[model samples]
Target: MRNSRNSKSNKSKSTVMFILVLLIVGALAYTGAFGINNIFGYRVKSFEQAINKGLDLQGGISVLEELQAENIDNETIERTKELLSMRINPEGVKEISITREGSNRIRIEIPGEFDAKKVLETIGKTGKLEFKGPDGKVILTGKDIKNAKAYLDEMSKPTISLDLNQEGTGKFAEGTQKFLGKEIGIYMDGDLLTNPTVQSVITNGKATITGSSSLEEANRKANIIKSGALPVTLEAVEFKTVGATLGANALPLSMKAGAMGIGLVLLFMLIYYRGPGIMASIALVFYVVIVLLAFSVTGVTLTLSGIAGFLLTVGMAVDANVLIFERIKEEMKIGKTIKNATETGFNRALSSILDSNITTIIAGIVLYSLGSGSVKGFALTLMIGIVLSIFTALTVTKFLLKLGTEMGLLSDASHFGVKRG
Candidate 1:
């Protein structure tokens, strides 16, 4: 009777494990198959929409601009970079890279933007902002403005609100008082932004500019106004636009290489370790699904180098399973039952796995912190892959192996690549 009860309990556990694995596979499939528009009534970006491609993968414009100022220090150059990035990518454009190339040059790469001249016009200008009276005399400069924001008025029309400094308040109040019933023109880089007729004296240092065509335009103007003018003038020194054809060609080749690598790894694992290898490969599929989901959710830009890093981490995942399986085989050869060998193997391999993964994680962090462009992208994917690899190896692979043993499918030493002594 006791033996029969034990058999029932083992069967129950195996059933639970099977259901759990099925749920995981179903979730992965649903995520990969569906688009962003429909996902159980909650809108979310799909896998393709979420994983951003870098400039090397998607052709775009690259602009190299030099600061047209003498004796430009690093502080000034950094400030220029910050302001320019704000202008070019105000809404956090994906895969946009801006870096200081030299003491006086800044390089900007915007992927998926085809218009080089328009980008140059937007970022190359000095963006000096001025407020002028009806007589065309300058009343206040961007330096005198304290803050700017985009918002909707009571009428639901987009507007840019401005807050002035104390000195600017005094000047604007006097100018408005004198120019009542006349216009006050706001200009940036010699181009008029808005010319609103003065209605009253604004002694409180607050004013609003209306007549923006859209919310996007109003927000863009507000952002530029808030960032103030570039401390130094920028001149486009070099400009290049990569063709989409080149990027299109490169991606398929990269995908084919990655696919071939993963196929070989799967084949080798299945041939060497038999049943346990099959289980490891299944866990590997889970690892990949989790990693890709993470990338899509986190909006990590995938580049060629990032793909290579991800593939390397796939090998690491295989290595972890190999370590545990080898230890399990050792225990089995010493006359231990399948259950005992599996548990002991996991315990023995835990320390080595933790040490290796932790060290690699540290290295990835360092690279992400210090590296630029594709290097940072690679490091990010590597770090993410390392974390997910550890999870699948410890939880998914172990559970699958235990299920196999409990069901009597993986009990022999030969199934785990060892001969019984």
Candidate 2:
């Protein structure tokens, strides 16, 4: 009778295991990692691939720029970040990070090699794009134009065409008519962008500024126009230029440390929990996969500090499994059946797991609020790791544990590391 009951239980667990494997396989296929794209086609780059590779790893010049602002409040700080992001992007920079530090100070980091003068012009220039009529009268200002793109003219000279909103369109139509045959002046922060003779009256609010001899100059003008027209103005406060080799040294050291830590963890788990520790180690790999997926999907930036936080969470992940296994051993020592002890052990450990993770998450939120720069990076990663750990531990680990028991792998307390007297 007992053998028949065990057979039915084994069949039920096998079905569940099949379903779980199918789900994981399907997910991998959908992501194109193990399907048609992997076998026959080139895979498209995910956003993570486009993510600004930090200067530390890929090699780049890191630039910190300080900006002057009337008010150093949160809104100003955010707008400053946006402006710097826009400013640095044109220099063919690999990665750019802008942050507010003290009450009135801002720090900017630009990765990749850059020319000093070009970098300065990109950030220091106050964009004030404008359109003038043939009569040398102002028709539209940078605020009136929405966006600018660079194109080549008949002689291959670079030109910038502007797109304007409705309000600018109406005003521009009236101005064009009045200034027919006059030169229209384009300016940036009172400096000349271009002064081209107006050839026609444009009523559509779209106009072109031409006569640049080089494409680089034309593109630079377009960027300046885009920056100046922003509703808020930017002042560069601090600038840092880091050589590209910094990451070359740090990355290997970090990888070595992580490997050592994981190795130590595996050794300790095997020594303390025996057979069940091996199972927990297998589950930890799944935990890592789930966490990596979360980071990629959430657009989390993996900084140096972020990696440390992740390693700490990995330790905490093992701690949860250790706690549960310890409790199951206690239950086994009291003479409970393996199945009852497994279930009861997990239940008894649930409150402790929840309480500890919740406290850590709360602490992470506080650190994020109080700290800036790398500290915030650490806090953000810690928060994400803690949340993902809960899901992996509670769902994935629990399912695997139950499956092991039903498969006869963990059929006896002794197999699960309970000492038999």
Candidate 3:
């Protein structure tokens, strides 16, 4: 009966272990860590692809637009900020930063190749909403426009159609009727953006702006229309555009340096920990994958400083594994079974792991709040790395260790660097 009970327990343990491994592996596979591409058709984005590279590594433009102080209320200020973001990111800019500098100013930084003049034109222009008659008659102003959206025509051309309120609709219908066969000029901040001729009476309170345009231009105009009009005008105070050549030079150098650091760290781990070091190395690979996935999912920007943070967290992760291994070795020296030593070592190390991670997280939070630009990037990545490291250390490493013990792979104390009792 006792032999049968032991057999049942071993079977249950095996089943549980198999299920856990499958879950972890399945999750990883679903996340595109194993496949050539993610479940989606697109190639799985790598660490470089997922985390947005910053200005130092990617070489791009950083335009700073400062807002002048006005008697703007909070609601209007928020609305204006939204409008500016829409204009700068019409086709969805990457790693572009738009931050309120002070109570009276805003700072815009776009980290990619972009036309300085074009970006300036976008940032400096006060998105003026306009309404004109079919015959180019001045009918109503942007204040009359309640909402706007973009759609595609039968020919697949992007069309920006807008709706006016009941009062504006009535006025717009009247204007359309009076100015048939004429063009309506839509001016933004006194600059003509679209001029379309009115064909029929638009009594539905809706009008479509049609013109020849590129995909990006259509999207920009649509975004500008959607954001409504800014309460206050803005001017570009500072703009800097970095050449692509400059970014090309920096990217390779940065990658080379980062690779060297990682290689050295891996080398040191192998030398110090031996067999257990290989386990930590495997966990580290998973660590990198988890970190990259987190960044990709969260859209975290990767600057040179962020990479530095990641490297530091790598060391921290290894440190946690080292602590657990050393404790297990000590327990083994006292004649504890391999399973008992492993279990106790993990339990004993839990508090220390939590304490170390909590302290690092607190510092990361403080740095994130106080830092700006690359510093903020570093803090954000560091915080993510620390949290992920804890998961890998506590969960992934523990599971592997348990599996090793069950497989009789680490039956002797010498496997973990301890003398037998």
Better lDDT candidate (2, 3): 3
User: Tens digit of lDDT per residue, candidate 3, span 268-292?
Assistant: 7667766566567667767877887
209-266 in candidate 1: lDDT tens per residue?
A: 8889888889888887776788888888898998888779888898788768878988
Clashes of 2: 26
Candidate 2 residue-wise lDDT, 263-337, digit = tens: 788888878877677667667766765665667666666667887998989988988888888888999999999
Model 1 pairs in collision: none
**Best candidate according to lDDT:** 1
Order of models, best lDDT first: 1, 3, 2
Worst 10 residues of 2 by lDDT: 28-37
Per-model TM-score on C-alpha atoms: 0.82, 0.73, 0.75
Per-residue lDDT, model 1, residue 230, is 81
Q: What is each predicted model's overall lDDT from 0 to 1?
A: 0.85, 0.71, 0.75
lDDT of candidate model 3 versus the reference: 0.75
Between candidates 1 and 2, the one scoring higher on lDDT is 1
